[model samples]
Target: MATPTAVVVGVGAERGLGAALCRHFAREGYHVLVAGRTAEKIEAVARGLKDLGLSAKAVLTDATVEADVVRLFDEAMSPGFGRDPSDLVVFNAGNNRQLDFRELSAEQFEDFWRVGCFAGFLVGREAARRLVPLGRGTLIFTGASASLRGKPGYAQFAAAKAGLRMISQSMAREYGPLGLHVAHVVVDGGIDGERLLKNRPEAKAARGEDGLLGIEAIAESYWHLHKQRRSAWTQELDLRPFKESF
Candidate 1:
């Protein structure tokens, strides 16, 4: 069998959990596809991986764009990447747009739907079309806590992510019998990085003695779910800090 290819969409050049996912999978001997909106940003991340002598490539792609999404997966299934049908596809798109719902405009709501929900649906649909015929593959979503329940101030964001969770369950039920592993992850714990420092400086200072969950650890969780046999499959996984309540 050919080596597995792992494609991660909406990757980041800065401190991103998805970037860490790329590294972890590559280290495990999977060809990594680092995709994002900007060519420069994608190239920078892919270069870092290539420098480490790992099998990784960067593609400038907008996950929200149908053409881009279709083309990216099509290329991944090509001969160059050794596209094993059983390879993993990690859907890690969307970013939090801080906007109060009381003042949330139609544009804000539409933007959230487009980036968070629509992109995921399109990506998942494309992957299903491509992988179903191949017999088996893993579809993973990197989600947030709000994905489960709607929150007071985070309506738009929560709704969008909730759509992804619903789709995950639907896909899992429909495709699980066909050897497809569909899993949704709720990463409730805060991640440590400069972004954390920039957003919550006080939290960072307080947690100096106790760090947040590392990206590599999170990646391992996804890998664990992907590798689990049907009898032991985890349909959903949620991770929160030990000190966290609720």
Candidate 2:
């Protein structure tokens, strides 16, 4: 049997959930394809994984582009990598910019939808194309609180996320019978990361040490989703800090 492979898109930041998920899957022996727009960042992540004696390769890809998304999957299945379809594909690409409806321009709104919704569709479609024939695989999308509700100053972000959420559900229904596990995860609270620590220190402090969602904990949930039996697949999951209000 070919060694299992995993592809992670939008792994630009070292401290982000995408990188954490890459590490988790790598640790479990899957040859990881670390993909993102920034070559340096993706390569650094792959290098770090290699340093730990895990198999990983960096593929610089802009998920928003159709050609790039195609190339991403092509590179993942190349002989140099695993030469097999990815057992797991995680679409972590998103743009979260808060803007009041009056201030949100058409360009800005389209940009968010292109990255958050369209890009995810491309990645998920490619994964489904490859996995359905083989009769097994896992595809996960990382969502945010905006996926479930639209609030003030979140018009663009929420609309894009909501689109992604619906797409995830549609894929799950269409492909589940074909043996693909499709799931959408909504992260309802702030993640414990450099961005959070630097920009929202007060929020983190208010939430207590464990108030922020741990990156590892989020990654573990993805791993769990991948491991679930077909008889009990989860179509959607919501994760949040205990202190976070609904």
Best by TM-score: 2
How much RMSD separates candidate 2 from the native structure?
1.4
- Per-residue lDDT of candidate 2, residues 1-246 (tens digit): 566789999897788888999999999889999999999889999999999999888998999999999888877656363346588999999878678788888999999999999999999989988888889999999999999999899889899899999999999999999999999999999999766777777877788878899999999999999999998999999999888899
Give the best candidate by lDDT.
2
lDDT of 1 by residue, 1-246 (tens): 577888888787556777888888888888888988878877877888899998788988898899999989887787363456436898988767567777999988988888888999988998898888876889998789889887777889899999989999999999888888899999886776445667887885576554576677788898888788888789899987676666
Q: Lowest lDDT 10-mer window, candidate 2?
A: 76-85
lDDT of every predicted structure (CA atoms): 0.82, 0.90
Per-candidate count of clashing residue pairs (backbone under 3 Å): 0, 0
